[model samples]
Target: MIDLRIRTARPDEATRVLVFWKEAAEGTSVTDDVDGVTRLISRDPEALILAESDGLLVGSVIAGYDGWRCSLYRLAVLPSHRRRGVSRALLEAAERRFAAVGGRRGDAMVLEANEQAHGAWAAAGYRKENHWRRWVKPFAGPSRPV
Candidate 1:
C-alpha cells in the first residue's frame, strides 16, 4: 500500500521541497538551484503543497494565482513516487486551491522540447495554446563584473 500525505508547505520545509524539485527536474531545467526556489516558496507558502510518503518528501506542485490568471509550475514527483497517483493527487489538490481562490483558469508553461513533460501535461488535460511562443535568454540576470 502506498501511504501518502499531502499538505501545504511550511516555511521551514522549503529546503526539503527544493531538494525534490531538483531531483525531478534533473536534466530538464537550468534554474534548478535551491536559492531561487527558496525565494519563490517563501513569498507564497499557501500556493505550494508537498506530498510525502514514509516520512520522505516525494512530490510537489506550486500554484500562483494573480487574479487574472493562475499558473501551475515546478511540479515534480520523485521516481519512486511516479505512477503511484502522487502526481495526480497533487495536481487535483492544486486545482482545488486555485478554484477556491477564484482563479479563472490554470496554466502550465511546459518546455516544448521536453517530450516527457509535454506528454504528462497533455494527458492531464493541458492543451497547447498554439498562439504562444516562448522566448528565453539564459543568464539574463543582473550583470556583475567578475
Candidate 2:
C-alpha cells in the first residue's frame, strides 16, 4: 500500500476536490460545483475527508452526519490508486467520524450502474438495503433559505 494521510478538507481546497472527483469518481452529482462544496465545508468542516499520498490527493469521502442520519457520499479513489487501500482508508476514516458524532448507522449513496463500487462497498462491510430506494427531485433554481 502507498503511504497515506487522511484529513478533513479545507474550504479553500474545494476546486481541487472537484477536479479530483472528475478523475476518480464514478458519477456526477448536482452539487459538484465550487459553491456547493464551499458551502458544505463552511457548514461542516469535518464532513469531507481526503486521502493523500505524498501531498497528492488520491481519494475522498463525504461522511455527513445530519444529527439523525450518517450519509456517506462521493467515495472515490483514483484509478491508479485503486486496490491500494485508499478506499478502505477513506471509509474507515468516515466511519470513525460518524461514530465520534454519535451516529447510529451509516449509509452510502451509490450509483446503480457502478458495479465496481458494489464490491468495494461490500468489502468495507456495507450491504445494500434492497428495500430502500433513493428518491430525488432537483430544484429548478436556488434552494430556499432555511
Candidate 3:
C-alpha cells in the first residue's frame, strides 16, 4: 500500500511548499517566491501537486499546461523520503493531470549540473535532449545574484 497521500496543493500551502522546495529541490526558479507561487496557484489550481505522509509534505511537482505546452518543474522529495516512491507518486499525479488536459508530451526542466537528478529522471523514463539548450531573459524583478 502506498502510504503517501498525493493531492493538489491548496492556496494557503504555497509558503510551506516553497520552504520544502528550497531544501529538497535541485535549484530555485524565478517563480520560487510567494507572489509567484500565488500567481501559479491562482492561474492553475491543479498544476501543483503535493505528496504528504503523516501530515508532513514529503514531495512535490508542478505540472503546468498552458494550452499548447506542458511543463514540469520543482520535482522534489525530502532526503529521508527519497527512494520511497514519493517522487514517483508526484510524477504520476502530474502525468495524469497533463493527460486529462490533452497534453501530448511533457517537458521537465532539470539542471544539467545536478548530476544526481539525472539518474532519477532517467529512471522515471525521461530522456535528455542533448541538442537543446535553455535560453533565458530575466525581467526586472527581485533577481538573485548567482
Candidate 4:
C-alpha cells in the first residue's frame, strides 16, 4: 500500500487535473475540458476526488451525488501507479462521500472496451448491470436558456 491522501479538488487545480486525466484516464468525455472541470468544482466542490502520494497527484475519481443517485466517473490512476492500491483508496473515499450524502446506490461509467478497468471496478465490488445500457445524446451547439 502507498501513502495516499484523498481530498476534493480545488477550483484552481482544474487545468492540472485535465492534464493528468489526459495521461491517466482511459477515455475522454464531452465535458473533458478546463471549463467543464472548473464548472464542476464551482458547482459541487466535493464531486471530484483526487488522490495524492508524496505530494504528487496520482489518481482521481468523480463521485457525483445529485441528491438521489450516486454517479461515479473518471476513475483514473497514473500508469506507473497501477496495482499500488491507488484505485482502491480512491473508491473508498468516493463511497464514504456517498454515504455521508444519503446516497442509496452508486453507479460508475466504465468503458466497455477497457477490460483492465473492469477488473479494478469488480475488485471494488462494483458489478455490471447487463440489463441496462447507457444512452447519451450530446449537444453540438451552445446551451439555450430554459
Candidate 5:
C-alpha cells in the first residue's frame, strides 16, 4: 500500500531509522542512534530493510536469521502511514528474507506487555507459547559487552 519500495537500509538512514525505532518501541529503552544502527545494519547488511514511499522513509524492520532461528526486531511504521498495510508488507518482506537465508521458520521477541505488538505478530502468524520463559539480569549502571 501507498506504493512502497522495500530494500536493505543504507548507511545514511540513521536519523530517520532511530526515530522510527523509538516510536515503534515506545516506553522501551531502545534509543535511535545513527552510528549504532549503521553498525548493526552493516554487520549483517541485508537483514535491516527500510520501506519508502514517494521518496520518504516510512517503515523499517530488522530481520535476522542465524541458521538456528529467524528473528525479526524493531518493526516500525510511521504513525501517518499505519494501517495501510505498510507494516504488513514489511513483515512479508522479512519473511521472504528469512526464507532466502535458509530459515525454516520465523521468530520475534515482542515485549510481553505490548499487546499491540503481540497482536500484530500473531496476525503475522506467530503463536504465543505458554510454556516458554525468558531470563534477564540488569547490571547496575551499564550492561557489559556481550
Candidate 6:
C-alpha cells in the first residue's frame, strides 16, 4: 500500500529485472534473460514498464505496441506486494500509454497453467479468447515445440 512509482525501465537495468522476475513472476518466457530483455528495451524503450516502492523493484508489465495492436506481457508483482494495487497501477499506466498511442485493444499473454493470474486478469476486465489459439515458431534460441 505504499506509494508506488511506475516508470519505464532503462536498457541497462534489464539484468536486475530478470532477477526480479525469477523471484516474483510465476513463469518465464523464452526471452527472460538479460540479453533478450535488453534487446527488447533497446527496440522499444517504453514497452518495459516497472513499478518501484521506495526505490525497490516491486512490480512490472510490458506494454508493447506494434503500430496497431497493444500487447501486455510479464505482468508480475512481488509475492509480498500482491493485492496492494501494484498490478492495477502498472496496468493503468500501460493502458493510458496504449490509449495515448491510438491503440484500441489490449491483449495479455498469460499462461493457461497460471490459474492464480486468472482471477487477477478477470478482476481487471480481461477475458480469455477460447476460440483462438496461439501458434508460435522459434527461429532462434529456446522455444516450446509446436
Best by TM-score: 6
Higher-ranked by TM-score: 3 or 5: 3
Worst 10 residues of 3 by lDDT: 137-146
Across 11-73, the per-residue lDDT of candidate 4 in tens digits comes to: 999999999999999877778788889999999999999999999999999999988899999
| lDDT tens digits by residue: candidate 3, 1-146 | 25999999888988999899988987777777888888899999998999999999999989999999999988899988888888878888998899999999889989889887788888898899999987876684666532
lDDT scores for all predictions?
0.75, 0.92, 0.87, 0.92, 0.77, 0.91
Candidate 1, residues 69-99, lDDT tens digits: the string is: 8898877889866777777888889899998
RMSD of each: 3.7, 3.2, 1.7, 3.4, 3.0, 1.3
RMSD (CA, Å), candidate 4 to true, equals 3.4
* Cα TM-score per model: 0.81, 0.94, 0.93, 0.94, 0.84, 0.95
Taking all chains together, the TM-score of candidate 1 against the true structure is 0.81
**lDDT, candidate 2, 4-107, per-residue tens:** 99999999999999999999998777788999899999999999999999999999999999899999999999999999999999999998998898999999
Off by over 4 Å in 3: 142-146
Candidate 2 overall lDDT versus native: 0.92
Per-residue error (Å), model 3, residue 91:
0.9
In candidate 5, what are the lDDT values of residues 1-146, reduced to their tens digit?
Answer: 68999999877877777776766554433224566688777788888888899988788888987679988877777778877888799899998888787888776766777777787788878898878776655443356321
Which residue pairs in candidate 6 have backbone atoms (N, alpha carbon, C) closer than 3 angstroms, thus clashing? none
Off by over 4 Å in 6: none
Model 6, position 1, has a per-residue lDDT of 64
Candidate 4's C-alpha runs over 4 A off are 141-146
